[model samples]
Target chain A: MTRALLIGNSHVGPYLNALKHAEGEVALDLDCIAAFGDGLERYTIEDGVFCGNILDPKVTGRKGKGPFPGSEVRAVLKDYDVVLLTGLRFSIFQVIRVFRDLGLVTMDSSRDYATAAENGVTLVSEALLHRLIAERLSGSLMMQIARDIRAATDAPILVLAQPRPTRQVLVEGTRFETFCNAEERGEGDFVSKTYERLAQELCAGIAAHYVPQPPGTIDGGMFTDTSYMMGTLRPPFWKKNGRPVDFRHGNARYGARMLKHVARELETL
Target chain B: MKNPYSDLPPKAFWKTGVVQTDKVHWPELFVPKFTISANSAVATAGSCFAQRIRQALADEEMPILDVEPAPAAVEGDLAREFGYGLHSARYGNIYTPRQLLELLQDMQKDAVHKALIWERDGRYVDMLRPNVEPDGCASVKEVLELRKQHLARLRELFETVDVFVFTLGLTEAWIHAPTGRCLPVAPGVIAGEYDPKLYRFHNFTHSELLKDLKAIRVLLRDIRKGVKIILTTSPVPITATASGDHALNASTYTKSTLRSVAGEMAMKFKDVDYFPGYEIVTTWARENPAYEANQRSIRPEVVAHVMAVFLDAYGLRKTGAADQAEPAKIHDDAEYLEGHDDDLVCEEILIEALQK
Candidate 1:
């Protein structure tokens, strides 16, 4: 059995929740520790052990009943064979904002994109766009955590992207209008693939592997399917009823699907 | 009889003015015909030296009108690499007066030079400013589309600029044989095949330079009445000349002709003035020359001194550096000149490589 430890922000909920009910001789045994917002920023790793707020009950909102509950025991890096770090702040929505801000158009020949110049936009070269994306990812929290983990242990580290926003993001009145427009123009796949490549390259800078979201779980070109977005796992102490639609997180099914993909990727590695 | 020479100031004689004077403190090198205050809506274009001028003015908190600006997201060297923040508009290094004249004319017209698009390895480049898009456009259609937008912005730039600074760069240029339109660089150097039958080299004569400058002035006034013009000859010499003359002789001829024409224009027009940038780098600094070891790129300190004199003469020098917007950190000369990342982005420099 492969011992995997996942540590990150609130995005860790689904993955840890899926691991709770996981049964019948699974090849992967998973453990998780999570903190929301800047809660993780307070923690530091030293001598192969994470220090500060190992499991702050007040900060994580887990109280005690969640799969990964509050504990005074600090997590050690060398305890696991493989380490997974999610919530490194990779978001396709933010990538879309960059494209819109720069008025950048890709030269993906397979899809017929409208000439950017007609709309007073500039067509950036692929090499240049790659540099811009890499620059954007360089200072990400994921990169820093990966470096920290690499310094502490020789264990293989995998950086998982935050689940892509739901396909419903393309609907009218949403803030992702430019993203929706790009989809209408058939540029979605190219942008997503380009982001994936740059994100992977970012991981490689620290000798870590970037595990992308499972292709099966994604709908449209760069968004998680609605089926996976609903019924998302949240902290147990959270509001029991009438929470707004969670468009950015995935349900336990997605976590199970993604977990399987991660296992398969690890076997090859 | 007391001759004109006897009564003249120390600057009139070379011995007192140049050889004996300290290089750091040359007296009254440039007396502006008109003052350019910090509020002046300045626009800059021309050769590589003009970029230095743009940077200096931007540093002093001058209102440099940039119509086609790099979006805030694109910062520093990358912004400049894509031809932003290099000039008032993205027309990179207008090496010849004819090219500048043609660009101004194009700004007024609602047209695209479709024939100017050249293809290499399935990618297209706008031959006019080939280096602006380092990777060529995806198609011939994309090139034309971009050029159309660029020209529109140029029109806006011309209409709004209060002061326009142009630096004369070169006398030699390649022209389309049929249309007589000048290209910024040789065809094959950046992109496209060099068809001798289609393009030919032409060196602008003294008379031709004067004529082109005349037409440019007329057009500027026609576009925006009473707009002031500042003309300076680039101190940096041509990297290579297509004329059969030796490189040194060719460079001298190019600089001299441009200097003469600029002087003539300033003499004729009250609104036009000549800044002795060429003289500052070449003549005054006889012992400690302004040029780097390459003899092409000017030293950063020299550039700063030139701008100091310019801004000081016009009473436009900023009083306090504290209030100024954090200017883009200017790179030193060595890195800018040594690598392919020429901050000046001189297309003419590419010619030296082709000569080998």
Candidate 2:
């Protein structure tokens, strides 16, 4: 059996919920350690332990709910066959927004960008944009965590994909307007493919591998299908008094789909 | 019975004017015909040393105009590497008066020819301003499109500048054989192959440069009425010369011609003024040796001293920042060299490799 340790922010919720009802062959045993929002990024590996105040919540609050509670996470990293790192605030929406604001048009893009030139916007080449995005990601907390883990153990690292936001965001239009504009302008596929390609390259820099989001769960080129987003986890910060669902994460069924993909990836490795 | 020389001030004599002048009182070195205040809409473009002037002005919170600014995500060293915030726009290192004149003409026409795109290692670069994108563009179409947007921003820049500061760097340049348009760097130095059949090495004469300056003035006033011009000759020498002369003789000839042309233009036009940055760095000082060991780059302390004199003459020094007027104190050679490394982004230095 493969023993895997998963570390991330609230995106770990779906994986935990899926493992509860997982049955049959039991080819993999998974353990999870997570925090709310960017809190997980605060931990530093010290004296063979991932130490931070945020990790204390998972140790004390929900003891018997999950396999291998957060408290033992730091000491057991080397014992696992593989470590999966996911969701330190990286999002496809952020990438789309920066590219749109910079007045970027890919080589394959058919969007009319003549207006961008009239607004005194500078056009960046795809090669330059790729480098800028990589540098931008290099400074993120997820990469920092990856480097910290690599220093601590020799276990193979697998970087998991964050769930794409739901398609409802385009209709709501309260946030991530750039994503909507990109869809209207037909730049959605180029951005999605570019993000996946660069993300794979970044993982390769540390001799790790990247596991992309399950293709079955994605609707348009840039969004999650609505069927996977029902009752997705919402932290207190995102939960309004009467809101019915979290528009950003995926549910247990989506996690089961992602798990199948991850298992097949591990088999090849 | 007093002679004409009897009433002359101490500044009239070389011994008192240069030998005895201290840093604090050195602001009198060059009297300004016009002053730049906090409100002046300043635009800068020139050789690498001109970046020092922009840095000093920006450090003091002066109102310098940047027509093409980097996005908020690019900051610190990354912005400099990408060639943003280097000048009013990213027209990198306008080394010759002819180059500057050509840039202004291109802005007027609002076009950059597709021929300016050159490929290096399967990646295309703007032959006009190659260093702005360190990693070359993916395609020729991309280069032309970016240049189109750059020309539009430059048009906006020309219509709005109040004071234009330009430093004269070199008289030697490589030119396209068919068209006289000067290439910023030698072919193959940054990108493209150097073909003698298609290109020629030209060392501009004093007459040609002076004529270009005249045309530059007319263009500036035509775009914006009463735009003031401050011209300075860069003290930094050319990294390499395509001229047959020895490098030392080539450097001297280039500086002498530039200095003479700048001085003559200042005298001929009312709106044009010359600042003696070349005289300041090349002239001997008792305690401060200006150039670093490389004998090309000027020390940071000297650059600071030169700017102090410039800002004081224009009454643009930050209030209560009197310490900026004093010479930078250096306690040891190691300490001095520690922080004084040349960080100017110069593409001309690439020619040094060809000689090796």
Candidate 3:
């Protein structure tokens, strides 16, 4: 039986489910190793088996830890043929700081400016924090884990690039008022520019295959898409002028599309 | 009043003049001629009601242009604080046709202008003085000179726009002090400080709305003379108004006036159509009598139904097929999950924190 191991951020969960459904429909005998959690932790693989925590206790702590432990990751990877990675959350604060320092973002809101010290710290830390983590826990760390697992059984390592879902374009005439309101509040410039930059960066990274998932798509199941769903899940308890107004995120339709894309990728793997 | 359904024949039995049968055949209230199919490049912009239009069209599988620069921040507060997508106030109103035209004008005049200003920093940054891109017209005169050129492009876009839908959001707006520019909301609402002397509320008279419609039509005709325009009045009420009128009364007056304007325009123009999006949503589809939440937005399901009717009438194709199959099972997953699940808690905290 061909075994596949999937790991990454929240995006991996939906993709794994999609792959499973597709395999069932196609009648393929494929055992899959699916591990999805925060990317800040280390996953371990041992003696032809995937085991160990998918998240490091030191990094995430118990409250923020993954559903499983590091031993499970090691055991799962040992028996899996491939590992896939994707993230739903992006550190937009960091991207905004980059642009702000570069003079791309000009306007600062009272709140943004008031918290500038705190935000600055977050921005600085995020920029520097990921690289060190990558050195100790990612890149070579994953490679090392794979090598160790391979010592017991030889399996090809296929790291698929994350899929970048299509961005939500503001419908003309509708979003302008809200956008302008944000601007007046002082945080407008920083918030708008930073978020946009973050999307572009995410899309660019996914397009470039710098992040892992599948070619030609970004993970839409991430926190970004789900947040929309949460916001609009229920219509606002009150409305004005008889028109129902609510913000939206990823509906089931978008989720389905992302799932199908993952299913197609699973076929290739 | 002549029956609007006069053109529609009964689906079941045809009667000569007035034959009656037990089988009642009500003509489909709306029949969509097309669906938003996959691979279509769709763009939506207009007024606040346009948001509903976009959502509905998106649900039907139509591709909406992601004008929001950043659409991938996992944290709600960060997304809001950063200004990703259409939800930010910095983009400053997506509903105004004039503003949309102005933005396009800027982009056309300067090739890099939009990318530099709107698409940079992952969001649209507020520009007190918008700079023209190098490839665009150098002066305001040059920009005006290219009005015809821009109009042509807009017309072309309209022709290919399988569904050219818009919502007449308001009959009231604030005009800029110095430039005499019309803004959808008051300066203090979005950007610029509120200076009573600089901003004055102007409730558009029938004549002004008619004039604007004519101008818009003329501009559109320059692009695609045969393009169809679908207009609707926003049913969402006003939260607060500087007009001295009570909020409820103001909302009613604005919506009624806009609805009448849309109806008149539809009658005057053959290619123009008016959809009872307001009536269908507020009355026919409303499950709640109040019609809004405390914040004054419409219910999601009501909006969904309004859009479904729109698609039914327009016959537009849907864009994303892989996305829509099995709505039931998907909704089931959400139902099965507890209210305060991990995802929910995180999102709730994020959105609440960000609002601050």
Candidate 4:
């Protein structure tokens, strides 16, 4: 069994669930550690050890689950065969910021921003993607996180593109519908593809394996299917945008799908 | 013989005023009609050169009023590329007063127009200031919605800013024929079809420049009680011209007309002040070919001198006597001189891409 430190923000939840339901005896022992928002902003590198956040007894962790690790927990990364450095979902929003800058949308209103991204498309393969993201890799937390772990442990690092946010229709006039209304084939696909492509290139530059999001997870476009996200999430922004879209974390089924992809890729490696 | 020169201050003689040793220092280069104190909120508009003022103000830690600032997480050149923190609002590169005035009108909310959006490759571009968003908006609704907030912010700027540093970059402009809306880049440069019927080119004469400046003055009259104007003509030459004349000859006509108009406006209005930024840069570049080899991009050191002189004359930063000893080079804005992120997006640069 390959001991893997499945470390990231809320995305770790689905991955953990994926482990519990893996086919036959899954050959991966997962240890998850994460904080939400800038929750780990307090963490620091003290001496040779990553230290801090987990030290705080009061941090309501990813989804208010208790006891996510501090910087010191990075020590355990040495024991793992592959360290999965994942997200606080920074890449998606960064892509949103880029589109907003490009003036492709009139409003930074979440609905308009989301609609633009959900509908935008770009035809980029890994080499082209790597070129686009190579310059920006160091600037992202995922790469920084992996680099920091590399400084302490020689474990191979693998990264995943932030799983697509829930695109469910919990409400009749949700913002996703606003995005759907605005969607075209190429332009809408461009936005999500930009993030995935950027993430893949960034991970590769850091010598980390870039595990793409599970196939069929994205429904013939940039969006994750509402089916994968339906039960495993809580919709914080639900009903406000006239849809209960959990634009952040995904459910267990989504995690299992992500893990299956990662395992399949690892087997090939 | 008490001619104007004989009785004038020492600064009147070239040897004393500008040329020789003990030449009048940065502050004496042009006495500011109004002081821009450290905290005074400043707004910059018009031309690519105007962006230098915003950056210098930010470097000085002066309160540059950027209402459409890129979000905090979007830092450095990437933020700049997105067209954030370029001006007081997201009104990107107001290359002429007409464009500036159009933005002011758009801010009125009622004056917002639907016809300004330009399309290329199935994407909608905000023709008014096209470069700010390179990819164009996904939908017309997105464009309008983004513009509504942008206009709201522009309206707020009149109330917020103490100084408006407006640089006149060009006399030649392309506008929508029927609507007369000023397009930032000539259509087909950034993203638009150059339709002869819909788009018409006009090289503004001195009268047109004066009339447009006065129009801006009239609009400013009602907006805020005491907004100071520091008008300057950009020393950066136009990259290409549609005028039948040589681009160099066209550049002379553009700069001269803008200078004359600026001088006229300053003379006509008490609040409007014309700074000799044009003379400073052009003269310095003549003495030392301070432009890049292409003769289009002004060397970063030249930009440094412009900022240093301006800062010494008006704001909190004053050039030291030793510093002014080299009056030809205002070296205070060293980061700009370092030229790290100075590959500014000049619409004129797009002329190379235009099908010649």
Candidate 5:
């Protein structure tokens, strides 16, 4: 069986759960090293070796969950032929910062931007975002991981971009989701192209790959379609007041769908 | 037997003018010919130093006209770094009055016929603004398309804006030899390859500077009949010179030429007003030193002082405006160089970096 270490932040949960229930002739054993918040910042290159006490939930909280990803994640990494890295520290907030600084959106232009985003406008072009991050944001987490992993092992790295926020995100209009929608509208391009360009550059930089979101998952060119997002998360989610948390995360079914795409691409690799 | 000096205000002399007390004396800085109201549509474009006022007015919740505003989702940081909120439109930095005039002309043109996209290391750059994009555009077509949209937005900004603020930054510029068009930066550093046959350095003389300033006035007049012009020279000195003289001498000559032209035009026009931003930073703080140790960058305190006097002199106070000026955000010279030293964006500073 081909062992695939799916290393990431919270996005790894669905993929791991999906592969667990999945039954197929496909020879892939999944392992994960997941953390939330600034967990990734701990895994630094110390004395020219790559390792971290990656299981400490107190330091990098698992959101009040039991049975954390095994402590042998770094050991498992060496045996895996491939590494799936998802959501390494980049946020939609960076997009908001870029958009605001560029004056693409003004104080009075919010409604127009929101409407445009609702209609599938991504304000920052994929090319522009790619170039900005590739050139200016080298200190980004993905960049660091790419460099460190390239140094540590012979196994190839495949970066899965963070999934698009759900349709409810746009419809409900939370501050974060609203910004994401506006970012999409203002950019005005196929949202997946951002992941592709970043992947292309990273691959060129470190001989790895960037796997874009499956084409069908994105609807109206900007957001993740509801079909892909429905009932995906486990333990569901909620606040202390018993209100359901408005997470943009998807379910194991969503991950199962994503896994099919990843398996197809791995055939060529 | 009253002498002419006897009747003059306290601001007339050096000792009684600014140095008599520790308290900030704002009476002498500016006496406006026309007041700026809260809803006044102010359009701003200039050298890097002009960004301070652009940001300050923005802070005061004044209506600074932004014709080509970024999509509303674009918050302050993104808008700031990528040429959005830096000026009235995304034209990057207009370092000189001539460049401003050229832009206004481009806006009026039915078709911007020859779009210049420079190529360096197989990537395309919008020659009009080489520094705006982090890397470069995908193609010449992309560059042309963005420039066309920029001009369209700029045309709108010029039309509706009641007040136009343009800062004069430099006298020296690289221009296309045939068309006399000003290049924001010298060729060969960021995008275009340098060709002596195609390009030449032109240190605009006082007459040339005045003519450009007057041409801008005329263009603004023709575009919007009642548009008022407020001129200021960027107090940030010419950090480096391509003129083959010492940087100190080049800066002195450049500042002198631009200042003289501004003074002459302000005196010559009914609508034009000259704010003492240059004097406030350079001459007024002779003892306290407005400039950093490098003598190139204007200190943050000085920037604060200049803008404070500016708002007090011109800013319209609504019912509950903040009375006291907040502590100014400071960017030292090293800090400015590492990140967005926007004032120097359009200038030919990159060439010096290339040499070393």
Candidate 6:
């Protein structure tokens, strides 16, 4: 029996079913170890151990640091034949900070910038900003994590570059407001370029496969929390009142597409 | 020497309600003396109609220098939405020479000035936008300086170009409120918040268009001396109009003005010619067939035919016809596959053909 470990952020949700479909088509035994949360918390994976809150409707409630410890990552990975590491969405704060540091954004006042920094927005030297952020959570880090898991499990490591979401869905009033704000500040291209560079760098040393999602394919089910309000909103679009939601996460369709590619890659593996 | 028109019937002869055969005397129309095919590097730009010209030449395997960037990804509508690759082939229309010149000048200037301001969230942000400026120009000096640099770049591009094609797209454009500079599209269409005070519409009259065309011709001559120019009018209707005229009438006026200017320029300039792309698509192709159900854009087959006619006019032929040929495999994978067409009544020959 061959097992495949899957590591990714919220975007990996849709691909779960796709991975299953791929396994059947390719006739490979596969196990997905998907971790989800805010910040580095999503990296925790263990059965029954909570790791971060589930923002998705498919899953319920907040999860603690998991049933499995970070040290147990290698042990759990040991049973898999191959490991796949997907990409992560940038934290909202990270997006805001990057733009603010770059001088691409001026605060409403100097006080706002200082306030944002004091509010746990990591302040680093201007020269080290991009490099520091890149070193910490870039796709390369994910690749290294996959490599470590592979070493422990005696499985081949196959890192998958994060598939870009076809659409950029913005939800107002949610914590995701920072991303939309950054996008408005003309940082959309900057963010995209950074992600592209990260993907390229991740694929450099590793035998990884890059799969791009078809452009403009996002529909309503993906960002279920954000609604198009008729009026009263600044942008006239805001998050609906209810459970906190992460509209930035990819829907099942995105996962389905990635799974197809993953399944095809596994056949050769 | 053989009479080039010897095969043609007399003009007095009537057939199909025409005076004589519409057959062209290829040798007379395209004299060998002027049929030099050099390894020229031509740059094509104009309104959207210019795209058709490029595609037509490309379909015939004719070499033309295309400076546009390749797409970043394969799938989806990015290529179309962003006006790159095949999307440009279908919808690139340059409305005026001034706008085209301005774009070239800006590209040239952008090469040196790499910084660009991106507007996000009601703020301006500095971002790195790649610059591929034309040679020998650092920054735009003035409108006249831009014109001079544009001419220089055109000369450089034409030195290696055997034929230069430009399609005039529109006569109406929005001018910058402060600078009085004409923009490619209205400000609000693509970018920038709509400010009525900051923008005003300028509809160029026939005389104004002619003056611009003359200036462009002089610029072309100053550079390449005798670079051949071909002009066409875009047939696509305007998405919206500030003229307060009905959209149909606006389209007619725009197309008519462009076509008339093109015709006049063709008559006046020795190296200038006009291709009837608008008439070909709107009248010839439109009258022939219905468009595909899903897409209202011109049918692929019609585009192909238009391109073929274009190639024939330029005395160019497709190289490696077999290489360009598409797959002809029939779907006869299995007996089960054949059962799907069970309702069809087939003759013995047809059945034999299918079996074969």
TM-score of chain B of each: 0.92, 0.93, 0.61, 0.90, 0.90, 0.64
lDDT of each: 0.77, 0.78, 0.43, 0.67, 0.67, 0.46
Q: How does model 3 score on DockQ? A: 0.02
TM-score per model over all chains: 0.82, 0.92, 0.44, 0.66, 0.73, 0.46
Measured against the true two-chain complex, the DockQ scores of the candidates, in the order shown, are 0.25, 0.50, 0.02, 0.12, 0.13, 0.02
Model 2 per-residue lDDT tens digits across residues A52-167: 33634456574323322342344456668888777776557557756666655443342223756554344766666777788877767778888888888888888888888776
Report the TM-score of the second chain of model 4 against its true counterpart.
0.90
lDDT of 6 at A47: 51
lDDT of 2 by residue, B254-342 (tens): 99999999999999988899998788889865366778766777877778777777887887777434354455443355543443446
List the candidate 5 regions with Cα displacement exceeding 4 Å. Answer: A1-4, A7-29, A32-83, A86-126, A132-157, A160-190, A203-208, A211-269, B18-26, B72-79, B244-246, B315-347
lDDT of 1 by residue, A1-269 (tens): 88887877677767866776587435776766666644565568878886535455566576442223431235787778898888746556556666663444344321122455444345555545666777777766667777888988999998877788776666577777767766765677777887888888888988999888888887776778877867763433122135445677777777788788788878988
Weakest 10 consecutive residues of candidate 1 chain A by summed lDDT: A64-73
B7-121 per-residue lDDT for model 6 (tens digits): 6744423442132333221112222223425344444667544565565665555566643332222123333332334322211335566655544444345332222222434
How many backbone clashes does every candidate have?
0, 0, 122, 24, 35, 27
Better of 1 and 3 by TM-score: 1
Best prediction by lDDT = 2
Query: Pairing residues by index, what is the TM-score of model 6?
Result: 0.46
Error of 5 at A151 (Å): 7.9
What stretches of model 2 exceed 4 Å from their correct place?
Answer: A24-26, A46-73, A107-113, A118-121, A171-173, A236-243, B319-340, B353-355
DockQ for model 2 equals: 0.50
User: 4 or 5: which has the higher DockQ?
Assistant: 5
lDDT at residue B191 of model 3 (Cα atoms): 28
Q: Report how far residue B102 has shifted in candidate 6, in Å.
A: 3.7
In candidate 6, stretches whose alpha carbon ends up further than 4 angstroms from where it belongs are: A1-269, B1-40, B68-93, B101-159, B284-287, B290-296, B319-356
